[model samples]
Target: MNLIKVKGKSENSFDYIHEKWIFKEIKESNEQKFKCKSYKSKFKCPAILQKISDEYKGDDSLHNHPHPVIRTRMEPVNKMKVPKTTRKITASKRITIKPTVPEKLKEFKNLVTAYQLIKSTFIAQVEADDGSCASILSTKYCFDLLGKAEEIYLHATYKIQLSDIKISQILIFFVRRNNIGIPCVFVLSDSTIKSLYAKIWENLILRIPSIKENLKRVVTDCYLPLTFAILEALPQTDVKGCWMNYIRMAARQWKSCNLVNMRHEVLKWSFLIPSLPPDQFKNAIMEINETIRDKKETYIEPVTEKFMSFIKRWWEPAATIISFSNSTNDSINISEYFDRHMGSEFGSLTPDIFQFSECIKRICDNSENTWKMMERGAQFELYEKQSFIKINNHISNNLELLSDGKISLEEYFKQAMTSDIHELILKILETRQYKNDVGRLDEFHKN
Candidate 1:
C-alpha cells in the first residue's frame, strides 16, 4: 500500500492515505493509532492501524466502498485572517492563527478552518481554504432531541460553495424530524463518489441507529453513485429515485438533443416514462427513440443518436424511478428553504466556507426552537405546489391500478402519456421551457 500524508478535516489534524483509503489519527492516546475514515460515515468500517516506533500494526480490515479519488491540500484563507489590533475589538473577536502548512503541497494549498461555537449542538463545520469541502453533522443529540422518521432524503445542492475551482455540489440528507423536514447531515466534497456517499450514510447511521434500524426508504435524485451508495451503506433500506429530478433531467436533455420540433409528441412520453413499471420503462424509452429515428429527416439522426446514448447511460436510475417513493417534493422544499435563508444571510453571491458554515450553524442552532414549537402543535409543513402533488397522486394511482390488474399496460401508458400530466406536456410544448442538462448527457456518454 502506498502511504500518503493528507490534510485531515481540521487544522492541526492529519490523515494517512494507504491505497485510496484514508485513516485518521486516533485521539487521546500515547501511541500512534489510526482508524479508517469510513468510521466517520454511516458505514462502520473495521479498519485500524497502530504505529509503534518505526513499525505499524493492527488489523486493517477491508473498507466497504472503493478508494476515493480526492486530493486534499492545505490552502490559505486570506479572508479569515485575524484583524489587526487597532479597532476596539473584544477578546472573543480576535482570531487565532495556526502554524504554517508545509511548502511541498504548494499545488493543493488551502487552510482548513473549523469553528465550535455552540455546545451540545449537533452541528460542526470544517471549511477548507478554497471552500472545496465541508461537513455539517448531527451528533448523538439528534435522536435524543429531535423527532424521528423512517424516510430520508438525500438532496444535492450545487453552485453554493465558494471556490476558484469548479465545485460539483454539496450533499444534504434530510428527514421529517418533528413533522418538518430538517437536514441531518450536510457533506460537501471536491468530488462526488460512491465511497464518500457511502461513508456519509454510514456516519449518519452510526450516529442515529434508528436510520439503520427503522429506515424503510430513501429518496434521492437519479445519481447512480448515490443510489448505489445508499444501498451499500444500508442494504435492507429501499432506495427510490426522485421522480421530479428524473423528469427535470429528461426535459434538459430533450432540449439538448434538439427535440424541440418533436416536443409536442415527445413531452408526453417524457412525462409518461417514470409512471411505467420497471419492466416497461426501458421499452417506453426505446419506443421514443424509435419514434425519433423514424422521423425520416436526415437532421433528426444526430438527435436520435443523442437520445439513444442518453437511454443507455440513464438505464439504471430510470429503472428505479417507479420504486418506493413517488416524489421528492419535501426534499426540494427543504433545499429551497436552506438556499433562501443562505441567500438572505449572505446575499445573492456564493458564500465562502466561513459564511457557508455560519449559515449552517444558524440553522442548526435554531432547530431546537423549531422542534420545541412543533411539539406544541405548531405545524411546520414543507410547502409544495399542489399541482405536483396531484400529478404524483394520479400517477401513483395509475401504477397501483396497473399492478392490481385493474388496467392494462396500454391503458396505464395512455393515461400516463396523455391525461395525467397534460398541463406539463402542454407547457413544455408551448412555452419552450427547455435547456441542456449542463452537458451531463455528453459527459456520461464519453465516460
Candidate 2:
C-alpha cells in the first residue's frame, strides 16, 4: 500500500484530496490529521498514514510507508444490519363519487354573472372616460379591437335611395366562423374600378396591420374588378367566388342566351362542378360540354361558350365553394337582421351619406358585441357539458367493471389515476376565467 501525501494548512481544508474519495479531518495540536472517512464502508477510500513533519532529517521517499495503518477513530466498530419487514394491503370497497348538480349549476351561474358584471363595468368605464359616447364607433376602431380577421367578405350595396343623392356603398365584412365583426364601408359616387378598390383595401390594411398576414381567404360575389384587385393586392390570399352568386350569374346568362329550358339544368351542372374532386370535375365538365353540343339551337353556342368560360375562370380554381355557399345564407340573414334594426331605428326616413354610414357602423358594433357575448356563453356551456359527459361515462364504465368482479380496486384506482378529467375541468375553468379577464380589459380600453 502506497502512502498518499496531501498538503493543507487546516484539517477542514480539502485542496489536495481527490473529490471521489471520502476522508475525515481531525485537529491534533498545531498539525491536522486526515483519516479515511470510508475506512469501514462499501466505497473504497485512499489510505493516508501519519502526517510528515518538516524536522524529519531522513530521505522523505524512504520514510514513506507502503502499507497504511487503518485509523481506529474512523472505523465502524459497532455497526449492525437491521432486519426488514413486508406489508400486505387488502382491497377496500369502491367509493362512487356522485356528481353535484346544484353546486355545479351554482358555480356556472356565478361564473356567467361575474363575467357579465365585469364586461358591463368595463364598457361603462370606457364610455364615461371617452366623454364622446357616440352610437357609431369607427369601422377602423372596431377592427383594431377585434384583432386580425381570417377571412374578408366583400359586397357592394348599390343604388341606395338616400335623402339627397343615390350612392353605392361598398361593405367589407371581417369574418371568423359564423361571427361577423365590424364592417368597413366606402361610399362611392361612381362605379368602383380595380384601382379605386385596391386603394381602399390598401388604406384598410394600413389601419389594421395584422390583416396583411392573417387575411388568408377573400370571398366575394364574383365581381371581376374586385377579384382582380384583391389578387393583385394580396397575392398569397386565396380568392373564392360565392357559389350561390355563380349560379345566379349563370342562370341570368343562360336566360339572356335564350336557353330557357336548359337554364335550370345548366345551373345544376355548374353547382355540382364545385363539389366534385379534381378528376371527377374534369369528367363532369366534359360531359356537360358534350350535352351542350347536342343542343342544335343556333343561340346555344353563345350559352355554351359562356358556361365554359365561367367554369375555367371561377369554378375550377376555387379553394372551396362549400364555405361560400354556407356563408351565403349567413350573409342574407345578416342583411335582413341589419335591415330590421335599421328600419326600427330610422323608420321611413332615408339617411344621408354620413347618417347612412354611421347607422351601418352602429349596427355592426352592436351585432358584433352581441355575437361575442353569445359565443362565449355557448362555448363555456359546451365545454362544461362535454367534460362532465366524458368523466361520467368513464366512471360508469369503471363501476360496471368493478361490479362484474373483472377488476380489483387497485386496478380500478390505477386506471382512474390515468384519467385526466381533473386536468380538463381545471383547464376549462382557467380558459373561461382568462377569457373574461382579457375580454374585460380589451373592452375597458375600447379596443
Candidate 3:
C-alpha cells in the first residue's frame, strides 16, 4: 500500500491515503477520520478507534469500546507508515547600511565652507594689483558668489532670507558705544511699523543666540518704524538717532522751506549737540528757542520752529544715551572701499539685489581688515615714538660733544647721519604723511 500526501483545505489540516482508505486530520475535531470502500471494515478501523478514544472516550473506556461494528473485524492489513514532513525554512538575507550625518549639521557645514570661499575670493580681489581685474571681480562675478553665499548662510543659520516678502537687505554694523560693544543691524522691509519691527526682532532674537546679550543700543536714522521696533524688542536698550542723518535731514528741511540761509546754522548746531553733556542739552534747546523768538520776524521763523520741534522730539529724548559723537562712518567707509577698489563704473551702476549684497559683504570684510591693520599701526606708532626719543637723546649728546670741542663737527655730523634713528624717523614721518594723504583721499571720495 502507498501513502500519498495531499494538501489540506486549511493550513493545519492534511490528507494521506493508505491502500483503499483515505484519512484526513479534522482541524475542528482535532482528530483523524477515515473513509473506506469496504463498509464492512477489514481491521478494527484504527483511524476511527483513535478518533473515538481521543475525542469521546477515556483510556479505560477504549478497552471496552468494541462496539457491534468493530467486534466483527474481518482482517488486518500491514502498511508502511511515513514520517511527517514540513515546508523548508530558509534564513533571511542581511542588509548593510552606511552611516550618515544629520541633515541640519551637514547643511551648516556646507554653509561654513561656502562662506570661507566667498570671503577668500573677496580678499583676493581686494588685494589684486591689476585695476581691471579687481573691477571685474567686484562687478558681477563676486557679486553673484556673495549672493549665493548669503542665501546659504542666512538660510542655514537663521532660516530667513533678505529676499523674503517685502524684505530688503539687512544692514548689519558692529559698533563700540559707552564701553559696550553691540552688534546690531536694521532689517529694511516694506511699510515697517512698530509691531512689524517687533516681530522681526523677536524672530531674530530667537534665531541668533549672540544677539540676546550683546545688543545694548540701536542707532538708526530716526525712522518711526525703526524707533518703535527697537523700543518694542529691547525696551531696556537705548535707541539713539544717527547724528549725521539728523543733520542731513535738518539741512534738507531748511532747503525745502526756502530758508537756505539757516542751513549753515543747522550744520553748526548738529556739530555742537554731540559735544554737550546731557544736562546742558536742555539749556542748548532753551537758547535755540530764544534765538528763534528773536528771529520771529525773519522768514526763517517757520523753518526754525520746525527744526526745534525735530530736536525736541528726537534729539532731546536721546541725549543721555547718545554715545557716538559723529554719525557712524561705517557706510562712508564701505562706499569708499568699494569706490577705491571697484572703480566708478561699478559704483555708479546699480547692481541687482544679489550683486549689491555681495558688494556690501566685500566692503565689510575689507573694512574690518583695514581696522585691524590700523590697530596694529597704532602699536607700531608707540614703538616708533620710543625709538624717536632715544635717537633724539643720542643726537643731542653728539651736538654737545661737538660744541664742547670734544669731537670734530665732521665727526658729530657723520655719527648723526650714520645713526639708525635717522632712517627710523624718516620712515615714521613718511608713514604719518602717507596716512594724512590717505585721509584726504578718503574725504575726497566721500564728497
Each model's C-alpha lDDT?
A: 0.56, 0.42, 0.38
By TM-score, the better pick of 1 and 3 is: 1
Better of 1 and 3 by lDDT: 1
Q: Best by lDDT, which number?
A: 1
**Candidate 1 residue-wise lDDT at 174:** 67
Local accuracy of candidate 2 as per-residue lDDT tens digits, 1-447: 223345333553542232223345545636555555544443233354345663212121221111232322321333223212211111111111211112211122222233332122121101112221111124444455423567666544432445643333334353544433234332332334555556555655665667778888776655666677678878888876443344444444545555555324444455434423343455556666765677646335666667566566545555344333222222221232232234443332465433444455554555355445444542212212323334444555654575577975434444543326434422432332121221111122221
Regions more than 4 Å wrong, model 2: 1-137, 145-147, 179-189, 260-263, 293-306, 309-314, 317-350, 379-447
lDDT of 1 by residue, 1-447 (tens): 435787667888877886646888788778877888877764456678777667666553344433454677635564246454533354435444322332222212233332343123334333333433334444344443322657766677663555333446666666655324566555655556665565655655666676667778777766667778788888998776555566666665666766765445655566566656567766667766776677757445666667656755665464664533344343232343444344564444476544554555555545544555455544443323334444656677877888789986656767755554676544433421222244454443221
Q: What TM-score, to 2 decimals, does candidate 1 have?
A: 0.56
Steric collisions counted per model: 12, 2, 0
How would you order the candidates by lDDT, starting with the best? 1, 2, 3
lDDT of 2 at 237: 86
Cα RMSD of all models vs. native, in order, equals 19.1, 29.6, 36.4
Which candidate, 1 or 2, has the higher TM-score?
1
In terms of TM-score, how similar is model 3 to the real structure?
0.39
Off by over 4 Å in 3: 1-170, 175-191, 252-258, 262-267, 293-299, 322-349, 357-361, 364-447
Which prediction has the highest TM-score against the true structure?
Answer: 1
Task: Give each model a TM-score.
Answer: 0.56, 0.45, 0.39
